[model samples]
Target: MSAPANDRLFRRWTSRLLLSAILLGVCHPLAAAERPNLVFILTDNHGAWTLGCYGNPDIRTPQIDRLAAEGIRFTRALSSNPVCSPTRATFLTGLLPSQHGVHSFLGGERPSAQMGPDAYCTIREFASLPKILKQAGYVCGLSGKWHLGANLTPQEGFTSWITMPHGATTEFYDAQVIENGAVRKEPKYLTDLWTEHGVRFIEENRDRPFFLYLAYNGPYALGRLLLNPARNRHAEYYADKELLSFPRDTMHPWQFHNKDFLNNPTSIRRVAAEISGVDDGVGEILQVLQRLGLDEKTLVVFAGDQGWMGGQNGLWGMGDHTRPIGAHELMMQIPLIFRHTGRIAAGQTSDLLVSNYDFLPTVLSHLGLSDQRPPQSPGRDFSPVLRGETTPWENVAFYEMENTRAIRTDGWKYVARHPEGPCEVYDMQADPQERFNQFGQPAVTDKQRELAAQLDAFFARYADPQYDLWKDGRSKAGRLGGAAGPAAAPPQRP
Candidate 1:
């Protein structure tokens, strides 16, 4: 054999042997060993109430429940904005909708006209979680939905990108996927494909400290999609079981878009099936981590971009499904679980009122990178809670969706609309379901004023001037939808 050919053959064999050694725990880089890896499992439009760990009586989510049991499950984690793109942007940038300017879920199955011919990543200008981690010498990979626009390319600091063609998912099977600049229709289940890609990324990057954004676009029970029966592997399991956890109530007057699917058995089963599918993927991921000996050295965080309501208050979807933009508890709270064995305590649940805006700061703080947190972020560091420390944390969280703004305190919640006449105040302790609006009652007048003032002050301190909708600031995506109320409409930009 020629000398060049012999050298190439020898190099290939050497590379294979080294990879085998690394996988077998025989060798590991010093830098990679010191820095704990990150596995951020982000789900789409899922509510905390759907999981067993969060007290759901009907749905089957044993894997997620095990994760919660083995780590810290936050009981009151919330999203700043109860939509896809806005809350997702908040998670990545630690900025609220007013700061990031993605006021709503980005355009559907196609590129948004607002972004022009050249695709634009909505949060490109901000210091994203992936970007920050990448700068800290960690290789980052994103598998699944990247709904923040420019889904065709790797955005921010992600090097390995496998994402949906666009933000929305019309069908999980035969879905269009963009894998490393190549777009193709994936025949397999989208959820399974996302899991497969995540596993591949982990195995490929085992030698280095990596950040895996294992995003799953599943259990997205909304619109016409919910009208059909689920076809995943778990469909048979949920076929006959009555998912009573999904309330069967009289149609809420505010519900317009998803009224048809309210209390529909097929839709309920579909959602349950999807949730179990995601749970299966979670189980596989955990198994892989254990097999690779990275379970203890990695931090696995599971969270939802926003919350969803399964026929709660007779409402079937998120806040946007309502005319005045609902900020109901079921549409705000999400499951936030963190499992980092040895470093974090197990079998614990925290009641600290936290938001997705606090995610980036807390994760960075947990990894000893709090100094890299964005200056404009209002996110607080709750890493101490993760370490099983009894730290005094404030019991409050804020929410915004275009013209609507809300403040959730320990026992009170006040939702205010821009230049509004129909504001809402609910004594959360007295009425957790938010059925009564005590905004104008003479007895609750002082309490209403106090909560409203606090909400106003929070937005005033955190909201960026250029994107504050209460002050006629524009949304980066486009105009608002389902804004029937007078104050819900954005002011005319002349």
Candidate 2:
């Protein structure tokens, strides 16, 4: 055993170890990256059919349509609730309003603290999407609307936020904005300003994995059109504007109240214009990512907080579910698109029913992180579907508002109103418009009963006893108060 022979053997073993480490580094970079950059773009009051990719003839959403062209689009997507705060909360925590307890708009119905016990506060106990991602070593940033609560200083795991305060009045230019808790005046339009902040966040965090929640409050109420009392001022100011318009055939009853000046062609065009402004902002954000060469590596998602009635059932805004003007497909169906170059299938459409609650899980799965199961969350990760893998997602998607709850399967939808109201059942395959309510009809009575049973079981399984109006009296108290209710009360300072 010579000393030189022993030394040569040791050197060879060391060289092999070094080579193995380099190979592992090159092959599993995502392990070191450990977090994927997540950009979740959420729009307020933007309906599913407003984009060109969604088969709308008039809305020129070139930026969003482009993303769809390069990503997978879910044609039958929906929101947990058809409102802002509750829906956003559901998306973040993967819990329905009944569980999260932010069932209505913030400051529009109940005091923030009374909404639930501190342990059940939507933003408190629930692990938010940004919060979870941050724990996994991702920088978290939020831009645009922060309707969950005015105090958006990352209490639930965000690092930076540039947001509009609760119930901030919408203006095209010179709107007030809050940047990281400081009240600031921004000269640009609301949507554009949010886009600027989002782009800046991306630029600054391009070197690190990050999560950016860009929640836009455009094309929603209090916009340029709704800001005018007469509603005539909108058309008068933007007259002859070549705004994109959906096909008249696609326009529903809930879009306008009547054939008055409020529902005139010009007013409709103005609504379209406001949406165009949001679309332009979307383009700016996308362009910024491309310019920074982060487009391919980043996972970008575009979705609306919820669908708007517009005028489907002679309704202008979100209607009371108890006496719904329209609860048809148009009012609930929203667009969900995911774009990650070479990861998600391009130019594809998935009929797999998806809800906003699925967003956090799917994003987490795509980033190669282990899924976190929240207590009693009903959402399932759709990463398999997004990856073009066949998934047997036979579970029905559930939606609720006030005293009404609806359940939709692949072929049928059943809606039931509590406190004694006529239930409705529709064969979505045949009556996609939901013009006919076949509940109690001799032909579909059995099917309706079956669906009702399923809905009942779903409620029993997922509905929190604390928030369930059918079981608890608190829900009734909150709804009856309306704008002056406990649910609408502002949050008390901690």
Candidates' C-alpha lDDT: 0.84, 0.69
Q: TM-scores of all models?
A: 0.91, 0.82
Give the best candidate by lDDT.
1
* Ten residues in sequence with the least summed lDDT for candidate 1: 485-494
**Residue-level lDDT tens digits of model 2 in 324-424:** 43356666777789998878879889988888877777776788653443535788888988889987687578887766678888889987756454467
| Runs with alpha carbons beyond 4 Å of true place in candidate 1 | 1-33, 108-116, 482-494
* Highest TM-score scorer: 1
Clashes of 1: 0
Question: Which 10 successive residues of model 2 have the least lDDT summed?
Answer: 485-494
Angstrom error of the Cα, residue 9, model 2: value is 54
